[model samples]
Target: MRPFYCLTFICLSFAAAAQGVDPAITERPPSAAQLPGVDAPPGPAPRPTPPAARPSPAPSAESSSPLPDKDPASRVERLDALFADLKRASTSATADRTVDKIQAEWAASGSATADLMLIWAGEAVTDKRNGAAFDFLDQAILMKPDFAEAWNRRATLNYIASDYGKSLADIERTLQLEPRHFGALMGLGAILEATDRKAQALEAYVRVLEIYPTLKGAQDAVGRLSEELAGQRI
Candidate 1:
């Protein structure tokens, strides 16, 4: 039972509950301070991202083509456009849809072999076979080192395995490959909070909010941390 196993269990339980399944949220261990670290940042307020232009109604003919062709650069540009839309989304529902579109772009690796390996790795993670999942993900990265999605998936599995340091490292790599990755930014915030680096954790959450303002968790987290830090000054 790895340390991340408990966190994974809690997350799965939450997902189940969200789907109207009657599972309870699992409690973390006393030492599981990292889970709350995401809510402890006390640093100077992070600058909000400047608002981008509101997206025009997407062309109907191209709505079906969410995934880009084999051109990695083109795919990145596609993702960038989606992220821009997400940042400017006027409604939470719109932001949610944009996030899904971004994720869809990330899922297509442009290489059949790497994509297959990613599926295997995802299944392994579901099965709680962290070592096996890690191996598959590593192979995927080897097959397509520039695949930001593969690195992000491995970072998630590493977080679940409680290899926080490795998870953070992979997240950094993921961001280097795709800077607008809100998922990686959120993970980095969580790890920072767990390590008692509350200020940095807050900054990470702030970044996530900037990328996706309708993200409820980050919204609550920013509120909570802001109050906590303000109290300390009293």
Candidate 2:
């Protein structure tokens, strides 16, 4: 999987700030995961086939559905209530250590909205529960089809699960939604690199550098591609 530079920077900064130190004072650890060979056991099985797209739920004929009402007040109130319930359910001392706690919190809170689903998806990815993560991201996409981060994350999960075709599709969608999404561009670069599409991969890395000039991975990618192109010319 491609390393997420933004996430790494944020995590490192947070760690440094926690210790009352300047983030620049510490050397950031290398961020790449060792890409194992084909001999390694494959990642988790592909997620179950997704359900057919269902029509969106429409407001009942009787009630004024929040769908038509663009008022933020009611939506904010519901969000507040949902967060309060989630906070209450997540208060168990042992919850931090147990997946059951996450499951219970999700189950108990009827108001766990699409935003919460995205949060859960992130946790699922960290836990290596790719199947669960896909489900949560799917829900998030259904709720907000235009959410670029959700699509980018789902693409990453697909990449990890070795579904490159699906990963490519999702990453494309992510880029279409957010042209400057460095993560998606990086993912596309990695996928193209793996497929031996060096020129395309170079373009992707260049695009990422355009958005995030300090991204080390993109710099490294450019160097690698330059070397490859030089070798071809020679």
Each candidate's TM vs. the true structure?
A: 0.70, 0.56
- The number of clashing residue pairs in each candidate reads 3, 0
Instruction: Give the Cα error of residue 19 in candidate 1, in Å.
Output: 16
Model 2 score (lDDT): 0.50
Write the residue-wise lDDT of candidate 1 on 172-233 in tens digits: 87778766666666667677877877777777767767776766656766777778888989
CA lDDT of every candidate: 0.58, 0.50
Q: What is the per-residue lDDT of model 2 for residues 87-181, given as tens digits with 9 covering 90 to 100?
A: 34433232112212222222222233654565555555555566776887798789778765567667666766768788778877766765645
RMSD each, Å? 14.2, 14.0
Model 1 ranges with Cα > 4 A deviation? 1-68
The deviation in Å at residue 99 for candidate 1 is 1.2
